[model samples]
Target: MKKLHLACLFLGTLILAAACKRDTDFNYYYYEPADFALLSQYLNLPDRPENYQSTLPKHLQSLGLAARPVDYDKATLGRVLFYDKNLSKDGTISCASCHKQELAFSDDKKVSAGVFGLTGDRNSIALGSVLSFSAYYGTDLFGPSGVPFFWDNRANTAAEQNLASMTNPNEMGMSHTDIVNAVQTQPYYEPLFRMAFGSNQVTQARVSEAIAEFVNGIGSYKSKFDSEAEKTLGYNTYSNLERNNFSGFSAAENRGKLIYLDNCASCHSPLQGRPEKMKANNGLDAATVDAGVGGVTNQANDMAQFKVPTLRNIELTGPYMHDGRFATLEEVVEHYSTGIQNHPNLSPELKYGYQPKKLNFSAQDKSDLVAFLKTLTDQELRTDKRYANPFK
Candidate 1:
């Protein structure tokens, strides 16, 4: 009887070892020792998110905002999901397909291409073109405190926005069940889901939440403007003061700063990098080709009103506007300087006596404005490994 018991224990140990070996073999094909090490760090325990108070310039820190607590493991899982083409119906498109990192997470095309080569109705909005995503959307949950998302302000949160993108027939073309099945079928995602959620179970809600957390981590603050602004945080009082030229700027750039402050700063705040109004009709068309916010709200007054985007990384994100009408900075400047049409629902700031007001900028003014706009580009964000595709 003692010998029989000992034999049974030995057999059980052998089976357990075999199962562990098989699991290791499955992952070894894709993950190297180094890759597993990276994965383990992200999985076993998550590092704290970057400290905004230390990372951000004091000028931005003064905005009375704090970073919301996010699970780093979940965000890492979200990063993989963001770049995974398997999320799409045909396995060709990913979140990264339309929103490229080099272009400040925006697309060069007027409208992004979707699954089956179908075109989207609107341009891909730049995700990281703010000091932090929290600053633009606010730390509040779905409520009056934060701005709604998309050009039309239709979605309330990043999760909602991602869900819309995934289900859109022309976009990812995945239903909730399809998305879950796709994620479950991927062997790589097994450990990712396990690490992120403490189990290898994939759910639609988990997928959306993880992607949302990853996107919320996206931010661009290390620009030429930030470098210059950091030096003056002690006394310059950037938002309230009569803006002065930065010591680091060239004469043309300084001139451009003045033009931006005097003419453009009312809409696009210089220091804060947030627009005064969340949505406005920028006089893109004399008549509303797309009803814009009105289409979402079913309100007459909201017609043609679109979300005013932050100008961070404006240098890289081009073929600008919701429709991608303007191709160059010069053309964009010229539009604001002279091309604003007398639309019925044009913002009050753009109207003078109920007509679109032209700035009458000279060639030099336009050139300088473009120069100043270039300063807003955050070079670090263009190639940050944290935001890059993890699938290799």
Candidate 2:
């Protein structure tokens, strides 16, 4: 009986190993598109009706960050729409044109160019950290305390934001009718729409919702910082040994982490919704030409205030700030350290009354901060086949 049981166990292990290998092999081949009809098989697609939760880092989970469940069919439809240049009126550019997957869904350009070489006034915010953003949305980062979307706080929701960009003259250059007409002309959208919505018909709302679903699915939780922080008592309460002997961080990086917690965490807290909810006037200018949040509210107090973006993947998403004024993290650190201007509406966190307060970080401190920031980059996100271009 013992011998028979051992033989059965060995066979079960072999079967499991073979199944894992087959799944791995399938993923490698599934990405190679031969025809549109293959999409019907749902190869390489996430399983349906299974609530797909974003894989948040342990630290975030400890902080009570939670992601909404995503429907695989909806997200798949969104993937198709995200890569389809046909969504644009001229059929030359897609949403992927500005939000490239390689760069953490942010353009490397200071200001991204739109359809027909037209340019926007502000830098494109990275959409890759969608899990964090989604979890914190409708909290302080978006409502009651924070302005909703864009550098200027122009749109309220991701759906509204997408529609705005799609219709903007400088962006995809399409009207509502244009978008519907464009999608209607594409035969591929019929099957995708059917799969997502249980119907072949496409609507403007459906298009926006599908794209937003895809954007929400983009998330990063596999960074070096995430791995190290998971082993410790989160980012705020690292013990000496945990700080000094973190798996992949250097001494300088560890020191920088302490500095960030002390000086930056009020606005960029890893656990709280503070990072997304708070907007600050980092004293960019004494009197700013661009109003930022003030532009949307037309309030003097809100002037020069922009949403504080998440620091995750901050290394890849540059040039930094609303206008992409600073080209490097060094420059950004320097600005906070010594270059803060005394703007009337400058965030109190960065000022004493009306006077801008300098952090007075040394040169080495700046380098260390930049080093630590780079640790936030998620290598897996850069190459994740789930978020890659699917139109090929």
Candidate 3:
């Protein structure tokens, strides 16, 4: 009897080992494109974006395009530039100082406290989904990518993205000359600068270029839904709650989707680009307020208009809004559901059949929407070695 029990135990162990082996085995060539038919009727884009006339709205169709390949050295230099403190006046703050990696590249403070411990007007936007801004690409003649970088769409490129932050007196507060001097004196940067720009001397332009590469690389597409959407990859540890959350919202959120399409799709893309373009201000407050893009242009019509950020990982990167006005996703939904203050320059899309300022979401409906948003979390990205801090 004892011998028989031992044999059974050994067989059970072998079976468990085999199961573990199957789960751990990875197949690389599993990914495939989504079916064209399903996306065509709802999202309304061509099967091949390269051949199709893009429906990206405004100048986005014209602006959005695939990024050209980058040099490995240049991209590496950009990573270094991102963490370097010489860019700031006091030589104390680096990009990572505010956009920490652990918090998914967002500062936890309601408003970013910068160089002199001065408070910023708005909360720091996370670095995720930043590189996905192809919709507003080529918007800037100088730094085409920078135009959409700031709270008010002020920066023109990722290279120029730090200009205001570094010199804002409240942020880095560093003068251009001071920054150049610091970089020039850094012994470790010489080879990196030389490799990136074919010279050891660091210049402002080189700094910008390197930083942009790193920022662009900060992008991601994998998430609970993204993986599930790709049947070839199969499923991993995603919970049933997350899946059920998506299905539950497939109805009500479908209504929200229609609402978003007629009203907000021109900017915050639900299905515009490869990953989906995002940007739009849904009349958050009364006119004459911050005036998001208008703040950059000083245009009256642009009042209260801010760039529509990605709903990707939207569940994580908040308090909410450029100003961090809403504390919870529910609050943001409620506000959009009802609280948009009427204004003269309000977005025309929000004019009729608008969701009231106090959206009347059922408890279940609100919970469902929140669950769908949580599926956007890319658990892998947070743990991936490529994007993780090298020091760790």
Candidate 4:
């Protein structure tokens, strides 16, 4: 009996020593309740403001997250919330009320209409492929960390971006508290909220987090242009017959290709993840009507500048430009062909100009150009199960 007791004591001491020494070596960062509380209050949620870790993937972390992942269910809920009209002040608006999915997340209106039929100053933009890129704020407001969102790169993170739209009088025009209340009161949301956040309790921060998650999940890639480029650039997807068509494509597409490469590529650049990201002026108006980046910078040089949207899925995300100003690819091509508003900030690539010196289309050229542009669409993204509205 004494031997049994001594042996038990010996094993207990050994186990205690291993727990203290070995377990201490492995450091697993975890979220404290206080962080969620702060986020719920909108106190410090740039996702990585103050280097806050995002639960994003390692590749995403290389893009820069401290070390936390965005909540997936929360993001999915945010998608439904985004398209939901009840959160608006007048119930006439939802996030999609301005940013339509058919138009690649943009509205057809030149300026978005808001509560009381108030029209906004700028055009709506498409919303997808959010995770592939980094945030940008002109003055390094994120401190050489990352670029923020918006035309001027204003909002620092997806959470903040969601909050801005909710409160903006010209947008949803709803209070954050009201949005939280609307979400929390729903029986459907409570189960989803609990599953996503470990608590059924809903709040503004979780709402923003979910919206950001949905935004991050929207990835648009594998366009037709991308396919062709991939084949040519050695990505290796085309058959020999498709490759044989390459010469004809080059002969036919080269003119349009040059226009795109020289002019459009600078901003829409190949794939969103590439290092040298693109943004553009596309010469809509040399004196951009809305004062794009200028609003954020107060700098004359940055006036009328908007982030260059991905040409991927261009066929679907139309009524083009920052104002939904051009409804068709031809109109957009022509703008670059000759309609440039000739301002100081206009990119120099246009100075050399189009092959015909204008994008005036013969029926064939227009058809070919459109075909080439259509290749930018990724059917998979449009049909992605992840991006579908959960409310339905």
Instruction: Highest TM-score: give the candidate number.
Output: 1
Instruction: Write one digit per residue (lDDT tens) for candidate 4, span 5-92.
Output: 9999999999998778554466332334454443335222223212212232333233333323445556656666777777788888
RMSD of each: 8.5, 9.1, 16.2, 10.0
Against the true structure, candidate 4 reaches a TM-score of 0.69
Per-residue alpha-carbon lDDT of candidate 1 for residues 1-392, written as tens digits (9 for 90 to 100):
99999999999999998778453335323344554666555333223323222246666666543345667767878888999899999999999999999999989999999999998999899886777775567424625646678889998888889989999999999999999999988766776677678888899999998998888788788888887876755344545543666888888988998898888878777674557678898888999999889999999999999988768888888889899999898998898888999888998888899889898899999999999999999888889878888776
What Cα-based lDDT does every candidate model obtain? 0.80, 0.75, 0.57, 0.59
Model 4 / residue 338 / CA error / Å: 1.2
Q: Write the per-residue lDDT of candidate 3 for residues 43-101, one digit (tens) a residue.
A: 32222211111122221222343443445566566666667766676666778777766
- Clashing residue pairs, backbone N/CA/C < 3 A, model 1: none
For TM-score, candidate 1 versus 3, the one ahead is: 1
Give all TM-scores, in the order shown. Answer: 0.85, 0.83, 0.69, 0.69
lDDT of 2 by residue, 1-392 (tens): 99999999999999998778553344333222443345544334433322335867666676666665677667777877888888887888789888888889999989988888898788988876444545655333335543367876667777788899898889889999988888888766776787779887889999998887777677777888878877765644434433354666898898888777667777876433337345788888889778998988899899888987778788888899889999988889999999999988887788866679999999888888888888888888888887777654
Better of 1 and 2 by lDDT: 1
Q: List the residue pairs that clash in candidate 2.
A: 140-277, 141-276, 141-277
Off by over 4 Å in 2: 1-52, 130-133, 138-147, 234-247, 271-277
What is the number of residue pairs that collide in model 1?
0
Q: Which prediction has more favorable lDDT, 2 or 3?
A: 2
